[model samples]
Target: YKETLSGPTRLISIDGADHTFGSIPWQEELFSNTLEFILANLS
Candidate 1:
């Protein structure tokens, strides 16, 4: 599924993270990765 993307793409999986990111550390990881992706892609 991820292979068909047209532009920049990122795949992240947080260890011990559930679907809802129901913990602080997991949520932080998610947010940090998201921000990194966004910053890297910005023109």
Candidate 2:
């Protein structure tokens, strides 16, 4: 499912993350990545 992006796509992986991020320890990393992505695309 990570092979269909058109452009400007990023695929981040949290070692122990699951589909729902349940009990995951990388939630902060997830949010940070998301925010960085958004900020970088802002014009």
Stretches > 4 Å off in candidate 2: 1-24
Q: List per-candidate RMSD values in Å.
A: 7.3, 6.7
Which candidate tops lDDT? 1
TM-score per candidate: 0.44, 0.40
Candidate 2 positional error at 30, Å? 0.2
Model 2 clash pairs are none
Q: Which candidate is the best by TM-score?
A: 1
**lDDT tens digits, residues 1-43, model 1?**
3242223342344332344455557556756677677778895
List the global CA lDDT of all models: 0.50, 0.50
Model 2 weakest lDDT span, ten residues long: 1-10
Summarize candidate 2's per-residue lDDT along 1-43 as a digit string, tens digits: 3432222343344333345455544755665577577778984
Instruction: Assess candidate 1 and give its TM-score to the true structure.
Output: 0.44
lDDT for model 2, please.
0.50
